[model samples]
Target: MPTSTRTVAEELLYRIGEGDTERIAELFADDVDWKLDWPEAEHGRPATPWIRHRSTPADAAANFRELAEHHVAEGAATEVERILIDGGDAVVLGEIRRTARPTGRAYRARFALHLTVEDGRVTRFHIYEDSLAVAQAFER
Candidate 1:
């Protein structure tokens, strides 16, 4: 069988949910531009990711260099709610349940991504989410 856009998107999220950094990188193209938008902008840490690209697989690997040492590797996470795909453009409307430590409280935030695919990899991605919800989730 061949890989469809919807399949690719599903697999990508599945990989992320599993915290498989390698698999996540594999799903992105060499020139993949990952656009991330965080609701924390007005709080001073304006998280606006216009693009995230690499020239080669090595570049992609390097991009995720920090993931290898992230404290939350064994996170208990899942994409609880989502409205998954759109053929070549995948859109996921969901909330991710994750925690840094096993004893920590689960952080919940809503997300919606508009992804463009090419050669089975994600070429461009634009993210949208309720920043307010994210901020509230992070509240002390």
Candidate 2:
């Protein structure tokens, strides 16, 4: 029997908590519809480095890697409030806390992650968060 979308979403969350980039990439389809809901240009500055266009599973892994590179690992945490699943889609509501390595400033922001799974792999991934808070954290 094929894996359910809920199972795929749960596994993805588990792997993310484990910080397993390879495992996370394995959960994605080759060509994924990835989107980060943040302004590309804010005050004439470009978006964060990790906010690039991504399609392949390798790009997904690289995205996580870039995020880690930009933030302090210590005291970083994700508090998942809830997960709602229906058919092939899952919506994860959570808050993320991280300190920016560049400025050593910490920011906490609520997030909504939408994942669409099909054929046992995630085909679409979209995340909405407080971009201003995150950007301020990296400001000098």
Candidate 3:
């Protein structure tokens, strides 16, 4: 049996929570439409290193690794409020809490992730989050 979109989405969340970058990358297709809701030009402050443009699975994995490197692992958490699936698309609503390693500042931000699955692999991954709060947390 082929994998369902819901299953793929659930597994994505599980892998992310486990900080398993390899498993997470396995779920994405070679060419991914990746986007994060942070516009550096409008924000004045530069985006965190992890907010760069990514298209390949390797880039996706590297992004997560870079993010993990800048955060404190001990108290990092993701509280998923709900997941809505429609055909091949899934939208995950949640709140993420993490401490910036350099500043030792914690930030909790509401987030929404939209994933589009095709042939059991995610092709589109778009994330919307409170970028201001996250940026502030990393401020020295």
Candidate 4:
């Protein structure tokens, strides 16, 4: 039997938790447009350094490195607070708790994601996160 989109989405979260960008790339379409809409908390600067509008799987994978250069998730944990699926689309409500690398500042944030799975691969992904909290954690 074919895998359900919901199952794929859940597995994607698992891959994220593992910091397995290669596996995460496999779950996206070749031409996936992945975006993280982290708001700007500083003038001309984004809250999270890895805010992305990745247009390809390789581009999406690079986001992990970019993020690591800015902040690391030590003792990070996430909970899928809710998931709703309809046909090829899914919405995930999630929360994350972690200590930032170097700084060792703790961060707790909630997020929501809208995903579109096509041909069993994610074609589109858009996530909204608590940018203010993220910015504060990285503040020096």
Better of 1 and 3 by lDDT: 3
Q: Indicate the worst ten consecutive residues by lDDT in candidate 4.
A: 39-48
User: Which residue runs of candidate 4 sit more than 4 Å off their true CA positions?
Assistant: 40-47
The whole-model lDDT of each prediction reads 0.57, 0.87, 0.89, 0.76
- Return the number of clashes found in candidate 1: 0
Whole-model lDDT, model 4: 0.76
Best first by TM-score, ranked: 3, 2, 4, 1
Q: Give the distance in Å from residue 112's predicted Cα in candidate 2 to where it truly belongs.
A: 0.3
* Residue 44 Cα positional deviation in candidate 4, in Å, after optimal superposition: 9.4
- Lowest summed lDDT over 10 consecutive residues: which window, candidate 2? 39-48
Model 4 clash count equals: 0
- Candidate 1 residue-wise lDDT at 71: 23
Better of 2 and 3 by lDDT: 3
Per residue, candidate 1 scores C-alpha lDDT tens digits across 43-118 of: 3332212123345545545544532332255554446365555667778777655442323444566778787777
Candidate 3's displacement at residue 51, Å, is 0.5
lDDT string, candidate 4, 1-140, tens digits = 12578988888888777777777778888888676765434423544546646878777677766666656655678888999999999999989786667577889889998988888888988888887787788777
Most accurate candidate by lDDT: 3
Residue 13, candidate 1: Cα error in Å is 1.3
lDDT score for residue 17 of model 1: 57
Can you give the lDDT of residue 69 in candidate 4? 63
lDDT of 4 at 87: 96
Is candidate 3 or 4 superior in TM-score? 3
TM-score of 2: 0.92
